[model samples]
Target: MLKKQKVSLVVLTLLLLLNIVGILNSTQYLLKILFSYFVLIIAITFLPFLRQKINYSYKLQEILFGLPMILPIFLFKLKTISFAIGKLKHFEIFLIYLLFLAVVLLLLHHKDYRMKSSSPFIKLSISKKEVFLTILGMVYSIFTEEMYFRFFILSELEDYSYYLKIVFLVFSSFLFVGAHYLNKWAASMFTYKNYISQFILSMLSGNIFLVTNSLFYSLILHIAYNFPEIWLILKRLKYQQLHYENDGAFFDDY
Candidate 1:
């Protein structure tokens, strides 16, 4: 496991180097290499094909991916650091509410993200209080991360056509998944059902951002993307209660 993890780290480092140089060179070959690296990370980390067990490889990938994901946001925050930090203006409040509504709808429809009996994210001791806390943490974590990745980063890329924007969103999400592949490889794998769902969702959200000229919608969608985890926690809490009352009838035969 340790050897496999070391190799994984090496691969991650090489990919980062290739990505940095490739971004600067802007050559097709470099882009191809970077893309391949991203795919490899996805396969080895997420797909069962690899037969390699590395301790918390997915979690490590999340941290690794998260750094690059957060960098653009950090730069934006720095650029705006000296700006006013006053009370919310009317327009700002309206935008916030709109974002919130989108989030609610997005969460309601998101299915794969929800916890299932066999999902890795579901733990045994979940309670209502823990569910709420996890939901809050997941929302905040995804919101800040999305603000940087989807909203701010997309804003940086030139969106000359809807096609270009779509390309960027898919590519960005690909990288986004790659960076955090360690934590959620299932969602990151291009071949996974959830991956396809997220890809389509991201493409739609990107187009919506372009059409509406509103970053608020994108922000809400980003937060809503995390609804699956929230749903899972809540489900676990309810299931625990029911199971307790039922005297383990569900598992008693086993």
Candidate 2:
């Protein structure tokens, strides 16, 4: 079992390195997209095997308790939910889940606000293939990331002391954010916003995994958080195409 854990950790680390290289190297878009899906498939396969081998127990209570951890941008809201959960009845787990959905919606609104105000209107000439690949890559990338940082790394440190857990959390969060920082999309004037958001989400996802003992909660939150950003990107691409055809040299203006 120990040997398996060690091997799993090594594999995850190597995968992380490969993912970073895929982001940093100026590769073809299709290749990058394919690589992202490949890494995600490996992560999805390995995480479940490792979890079973390690006998990781997931509890319904922990999953409910962890739902509020998604509101990392609103710490006070999370704290309130955490406090309220203890007083609620066992049947109120459903209520808590409903509340979690509400919080997710609110967070999505907040994300939309930030994205509208901060994200640059890049005049992209993306084809249908590129659009499909980008969306697939984004979803796959998120899955791979949550599997590695939350399920693999954080789960392994579960038996450690609080201090040790915190140390690993910070280390893993740095790696998560660093991966994004190295990405081509984030290497721009507005890069700091991406870095800050990624760091906070990484920390929050780690905490969610700690509380829930399940990767599903964090994975849902990650996808919810990214949905608006992806939509905006697609909308902008469509808008850019319309204007580019209407006015020649429209791309040059941006």
Index of the highest-TM-score prediction: 1
Looking at model 1, the pairs that clash are 58-182, 58-183, 65-179, 113-228, 114-228
Each candidate's lDDT (Cα)?
0.52, 0.54
Model 1 weakest 10-residue run by lDDT: 78-87
Candidate 1 residue runs with Cα over 4 Å from true position = 1-24, 27-68, 76-123, 158-163, 180-191, 239-254
Clashing pairs in 2: none
Q: How well does model 1 score by local distance difference test?
A: 0.52
- Residue-level lDDT of model 1, residues 71-102, one tens digit each, is 54454352231112233463465465446545
User: For candidate 2, which ten residues in a row score worst on lDDT?
Assistant: 75-84
Query: At residue 236, what lDDT does model 2 achieve?
Result: 66
lDDT of 2 by residue, 1-254 (tens): 23434454465566556657775453343233234433433443344455567766533222322332222213222112121222234324434543564464555456655657455654555555556656766666676567556655565565689998888788778767754543323445335655666666677767766766666657666876687667766776776677666434423434
How close to the true structure is residue 8 of candidate 2, measured as C-alpha lDDT?
43
